[model samples]
Target: MSDDRPLDPVQLDAYFALIEVSSLLRHTVEQQLKESGGLSYVQFQLLATLGDAPSGRRRMTDLADGVVYSRSGLTYQVGLLEQAGLVTRAPSQEDERSVVVTITDAGRAVLATVFPGHIAVLRELLLDPLSDDDVEALASVLDRVRAHMRSIPPRSAAPRRRAPTR
Candidate 1:
């Protein structure tokens, strides 16, 4: 089931570079989110997603999928946000079994506080060194890779099966 062939030098170098850069970027972003808004990266993502939605609301399952997070983890984060008065959870009127999350005004205010710093960090660490052409190429490549990865069933769609006992 395994390929015997190893990655070529170019592929190995690119893979390592990508992994390192992604880690660095996420670490910086996490720090910025925590410092500016007292939010974790995941919490910021949830609020930003809801804030960008047309109605400032989304179903729990949809949020999990959109954020590429586990439903249980998303639930925990939502609970924290609810406790902080940053968001609300309510039953969906259209679907009795579904719960919807809506961002509060306070959440928007946090976004406003954090976004400027976030953008500045991104610009300084990630984008400033890139040429316009490099930026466009990177965006295009990432978009395609993301779409391909997302074609698989997301964690929110179903629970993982338990392993059979020996």
Candidate 2:
């Protein structure tokens, strides 16, 4: 009998490569955003997310998730924006425990000014080197990977059972 245990080699390689590339790409984009827009990447991300939200506002937790930041980090960033008069936070009508973050007119104006430059720099860093066909192929592959990931069941954080009484 052959003793070959089951393992997903392709998934393992893809997962590792994704982790490495995500970190590197994020850092590179962060540097570009800082230099070109004079805005930290987190601030730019928050403004963009807020602009995309319905009513130009989102629960603070939603904004935090969009930017991959902790709740306190989002609070601090929003506090800075509030000080700059670029954004406002108010109580959420839908949920008392949640705060709604909305971008102010000044924030929208700044985002508009920075948008074009951001697109140009993104192309320069990531897409300029790839041909249309290559980009399409990469996009297709990524879509497949994302779909596969979505197919997997979410991890269950089931509570542990206490030892049975003797």
| Ten-residue region with minimum lDDT total, candidate 1 | 151-160
lDDT of 2 by residue, 66-122 (tens): 576777777998999888888999999989998998999998888887888788766
List candidate 2 stretches off by more than 4 Å: 1-24, 143-166
Q: What's the number of clashes in each of the models?
A: 0, 0
User: What TM-score would you give candidate 2 relative to the actual structure?
Assistant: 0.70
Instruction: Report the lDDT tens digits of candidate 1 across residue range 65-158.
Output: 9988988899999999999999999999999999999999999999999999999999999999999999999999999999987886765566
Best by TM-score: 1
RMSD of 2: 5.5
lDDT of 2 at 79: 92
- The candidate that achieves the highest lDDT relative to the unseen native structure: 1
All candidates: TM-score: 0.91, 0.70
Poorly placed runs, candidate 1 (over 4 Å): 154-166
lDDT (CA) for every model shown? 0.94, 0.80
